[model samples]
Target: MSSSSSSSFIIRIFIICGTIFNLSHQIKTIDALQPMKSSSLFIVFGRPGSGKTTVANKAFESLSLDNNKNNKHQQCIELDLDVCISQEMKDNFGRGIYPSLKERNVFASGACDYVEKQLDEKLLKCQQQKQQQKDFNLSAIISFSFVNTDLRDIFRERFPKAEWILIDTTEEECTKRINEREGHFYKGDTPDKKKKEEEVDTTTNEEKDMSDWEFNPVTFPHIILDGNDPIEDNANNVVKEILGKNEEI
Candidate 1:
């Protein structure tokens, strides 16, 4: 089935399931939330080696094609969460072996601060252009794993209106890719340990702690995409939603 049809079917199931329990009144319109006008913050979330950055970049390209046609002063940037950490943390993390949770936490905790600092600089630049009576278009794509749910509090309550794109991929696949990929923080000089999380790569016993590991779609209005799919292909799907091409009737 087409992606849109799949979404419709899921919603129908939700509606029917709700009605069966006499809780149909609780069902609300399930719409894809758009980013704030003129300035947008698109969060591209997934696990390590799950193509989050590739997806974010492709989505940014689409953003330009769809939103910057007439704007002369347009600015778009992609911020990888790794930038939040110091060089020492990144270099020492895993010591060229698997992933390091301790160092990752520092990066995760400082995500909000990093985004605000980036936006502040961008807005300042926008103000300068506006002073010259020119219009400015500002947008961003923040790509990160956010393996810990606590990292979400860094944004949800703050930038509640930002667009969220979840790249869903299997933990096994992510681990395999992380081991195969070269020159990534998750890789090692040789095969090392698996980066396990109570949330992202949960064991059978830790199922109850699932929310602590991965981002939950039901908690908020967001679009879900298969991370294993081709980057540009997945990106086009997201663009269709942003441009309302796949918006349900």
Candidate 2:
């Protein structure tokens, strides 16, 4: 065979071998992770504008179960509570919901309810299907600020093997980010809407018990990730850290 043809043949062989290796790895991982071994609740905790979403998006993309026949829906699904709440608000009300920075407690209370519901539903399904180890594949990555210990414990109970990540940035930087950020629910496109959203009492606490989680001083033990760096770089580094940790599994 010609050298070029030989090279092409070798490449095809490599691809086929890689596929087999990937399948083997998937099965091995599934067996090892029986009863949700590969499972972990990656907590992206930070005040607004600390690049929580960016790192989260990157982590979701980077982490995944190896390709297997029963793993079509396999992925690191992000339960971004902020987006979920905005969506929830839109569903209940006729328009979008935008809570001010100070009204974070209201947002958190609503989001916690929604997050718990999601966990209950997903975990129920997982428990029901735990016997099917061959098809076992599900992991939830929640991106939210666990400003208090109670909220953190709630998720921890549902997902015992939780991973904590706190994006460290000053409030001054977060304020600057709040002003510069666009397409945010609270950070409206038009000046008028922005002013209105920024104004207090625009979002009613229908239930007064929705006190803020920030009052809880206890923060979960977390890996401090630098949020000041370029988003992509920061994301890639966070992926490296997570993947590095999972290399043993």
Candidate 3:
């Protein structure tokens, strides 16, 4: 071929390659801009009296109201282990509180079942609502004293994508809160409210004292929030973290 003809052919090839590259880049940009379908499960946990439920509830309310940064298609649910425990007690024992180690163990197992059932239901619902091959987002905010690493592992295995949030507080502060709180079985005063009233101590009994339980990260990454901070601030920070504003969701 002549030099001019060869040059023209090379130019045509370059133009085709550039067009393909631009199209690929534009596709990626559009995908990045689009709202992704997500199933966000956040487990807010800490030792008992660390205000896990308080902040978890506040974050749930805030995230719900904001629709998690205006993702209108998202569905959010809050699950409290205490609430499940209460229900379990009421349904099986016709009581609101369980004090004995045997009773507590029974109720705790029942409560875990309840939580897992709710999670399974949510997962099924999300699976069924396959609209146009684009599933709407489902956000589950769960609160519990997930201090036992083994128990945490059970959930981590069940929901491989679940995010963990830990509310960090000193044992002293937790003991104070437990003492001040009323109407709960895990109150500061136990086994008759006198010798046990002054301090919250761990026991080697069958039913472990949750206040004495400490968190072990154990291969799982978690978002830690200061328990000393205002609950509202912690709540807002968690929402930001979950919404991918402060950190990767």
Q: Write the per-residue lDDT of candidate 3 for residues 21-108, one digit (tens) a residue.
A: 9999999765544444355778888877899899988988998888646665556789987775554544432221324545545555
Backbone clashes for every candidate come to 2, 0, 0
Better candidate by lDDT, 1 or 3: 3
Q: In candidate 3, residue 49 scores what lDDT?
A: 88
Model 2, 35-110: lDDT tens digits are: 4444445677777677788778876766653323334434345788766555655432223233344355465566
**Cα lDDT of model 1 by residue, 94-194, tens digit:** 55322244444455557776787787676665554442123444667788776665466557766776788888888788878778877766552332233
Clashing pairs in 3: none
The total of clashing pairs for model 1 equals 2
Q: Rank the candidates by TM-score, best first.
A: 1, 3, 2
Among all windows of ten consecutive residues in candidate 3, which has the lowest summed lDDT? 90-99
Point to the candidate with the largest lDDT.
3
Please say which candidate is ahead in TM-score: 2 or 3: 3
